[model samples]
Target: MSRAGRLGVGIIGAGKVGPVIGAALAGAGHALTGITAGVDEERVQAILPGIPVLDALEVVRRSELVVVAVPRDELPGLVTGLAEVGAWQPGQLVLHTDASFGTGVLAPAAASGAIPLAVHPAIAFTGTSMDLRQLSNAYAAVTAPAAVLPIAQALAVELGCEPVVIAESDRLAYAEAIAISTEFSRSIVAQAAELLRGAGVPHPGSYLSALVHSTVDHALSQAGSAGAGPPAEALEG
Candidate 1:
C-alpha cells in the first residue's frame, strides 16, 4: 500500500526484542507512536526516555502496523487477548518475531481482519542502546499469507536484513535449523574461552570474536565464488 508512509508502528511488548527493534525501525524513519510496556514508569523511562509508554491495548489502538515483540511463549496469550478485546484493526498488520511459530498461531487475529505475519530476525536482541549499532547485516525468516508477503518483505528490508521466505508450515523446522547454528557457534565460543583461560590469554572474548568474524568473512567470500577460486582461499585471503 505505497509503503504505508512510515507506518504508524506500535510495539505491544517493549521488552528486550520489542524496544530494540522498535527503536531500530524508528531510526529507519518509522513513526514509533511510543510503545506498550507493563514495566513501572521508572523502568520504562530508563529504556526510552521522553517516549510515552502506553498500555498494550492502547498500543494496538493507536498504530496501523502493530508489532508483537513478546517472547514466543507469550505470543499466543497476548494475541488472543488482543483478539478477544477487538483491539486489532482491519488494515493493521500484525507481525511477530518468534522463530518457532507461524501466522497459524495468530489465526484469530487474521480472522479478525489483521494481516498475521511471522517475521523472525536471525539475530538475538540484547535490549540495550547498542541494539541500533548491531542491526547491520541482520537476517530474517519471514512467512506470510501470499497477499501480505510484500508487507513482511518490506519490513524486513527496512531492518537492513536479507529476508528469506519460507513456508509457514516449515517455520518450526527453520527454527530448529537456526537453533542448531546458534548453539553450535555458542558452544564453540564457550570452548574457545575455556581454552584461552587455560592458556592465560587476557580478554579472550575479544580475540575469539575477531577470529570468528574473520573465518566467517573468508568462508562467505569463498562461497560467493562460482568456480575454481583456489580452494581454501580463505587462509590466503
Candidate 2:
C-alpha cells in the first residue's frame, strides 16, 4: 500500500500497545475507523476517545490498514483465521507489532493480497499518552518486502520512531535483546527492592525508583557522548 494519503486504520486488539499506537497513527493524520472492544470497551474508549469499538473482523473489513497488536503467540493464528474467513482486502496493509516474528508470520494475510509488515517499537508501553514521549526517542524494528519498505519506514516515522530494519533471520535475537533490556532490568530492580525491604529500609521502592531513573539517564547520556552502546552493567544497574 502506498501511503500517498491518510488511510483508514483499525486495531485488532484492545490491549496496551494497540490503542496507543492507534492514537499515534491517528495523530499522524490517519483516520481510526474502529478498534476491537471485546470486554474492554470502556478501557479502549478511555484511551482512544471518539473511535468506534467494533468486532475484530468488522474492524478488519472496514479498514484500509489493519494493525494486529495481539499477544505475540496469538498473531499467526489470528492472521490465519482472518485469511480463512476471506476478511483481508486486496492491497490492504496488515501490520503486526511482534518483535519475535517478522513479516513472514503474516503469510496468510499476504496470500490474501494484504501487504505484511512487522513493526515493533523498542520502548516499553505504559498504555497511556506518556508513552508518546518515549516513542519520539525510541527505535522501531521494521521488516517488510522491499517494495513496501518505505511505507513501513514512513509509518514508523509518523509515530515518532526511528526505523531500524531487522532481518527475518535476526528477529528472535532482536526480540531477546529487548526482553533482556526491559524485562530482565525490571526483575533485577525487584530483587534489589526485596533486599532493601529485608534491610528495613523505609520506602525502598520510591528511593530505588529515583536511583534507577538517574542511573539510566546517565548511562544513556554516556552512550550518546561515547557514540557506543551502554555497557551491560550500566544497562542492568
Candidate 3:
C-alpha cells in the first residue's frame, strides 16, 4: 500500500513510547485519533493537545487499530484488561512494542478474536518530541499472521522504516540483541571519551560520536563479507 491511505491508529498508552510514535505516525499520514494516558498531566497535555485523550478501554473501542506501548511488566495486565472489557473488535489490529516476545504474548487478545500484530522499532528512544522525526528512517521488527503480513509491513513502511520480519519464536532473541548492541555502544563510547579526556580534548562527545560512526561502519563492512575469514583478520582490516 502507498502512503496515501494510511490506517488510523489508536494509542492506548501515551507514556514514553505511545505518544511519540503516534505523533510520528500521524505525521506519516496515519490518523492518530486518540491517545490514553496515566502519566504526568502537564507532560501529556503539552504533547498531545486537540487530539482526544481517552481512558485505555475507550481508546480500544474507538479505533480500528490498538497499540499497546506500556511498560513490559504492565503489558500483560493491560492487555488482559482490554480483553476483559470486550474492547477489541474482530479484525481490529492489536499491536504492541514488546520485543521480548512475539505475537504469542498477544494470545489473550487474539483469543478475543482480534487480529494481533506486534511492531518493535530497533532504535533507542529518547522520550522526546524531537525523537519523533527519527522514526522516519528507523528500523522496525514486525510479527503478524500471514494473512495480513502486508498490513503489518505497511505499517512499518508508514513510519518510513524498513520492516524486518521476526519469526514468532525469535522475538526474544532479537530483543536481547538490541540490548547487547546498546550496552556495547555505551561501554565503547565511555572508554573512548576517557581516552580523549586524557588527550586534553575540550569536547569529547563529538569525537566519540565520530569514532562510534567509524567503528559501526567498519563492523558492518566486515559483517558483509561472508568470507571475512577470521575474526582477527577482520578486526585488523
The TM-scores, one per candidate, come to: 0.83, 0.90, 0.84
Better of 1 and 2 by TM-score: 2
Task: Report how far residue 162 has shifted in candidate 2, in Å.
Answer: 0.9
On lDDT, the candidate that comes out on top is: 2
Please give the lDDT score for candidate 2: 0.87
Question: In candidate 1, which residue ranges exceed 4 Å CA deviation?
Answer: 1-4, 38-47, 219-237
How high a TM-score does candidate 2 get? 0.90
lDDT of 2 at 30: 90
Candidate 3: RMSD over Cα atoms?
Answer: 5.6
Residue lDDT tens for model 1, 1-237: 244577888888877788777776776788878687655545455656677788888988888888888877889998998889998888788999889988898888888899998888788677776655666666677888888887787788787676778787788898998898789878988998999988998888987887899997887687667552333223112
* Residue 46 miss distance in model 3 (angstroms): 5.7
lDDT (CA) per prediction: 0.78, 0.87, 0.77
Task: Answer with 2 or 3, whichever has the higher lDDT.
Answer: 2
- Provide the global lDDT of candidate 3 against the true structure: 0.77
lDDT of 3 by residue, 1-237 (tens): 555666778988777778777776777777877887666656655666567888888788778888889888888888888788787788788989877867887888899888888888877776677666677767788888889877888787776677778778887788888889888888878888889899999789887777679988898688768653234223212
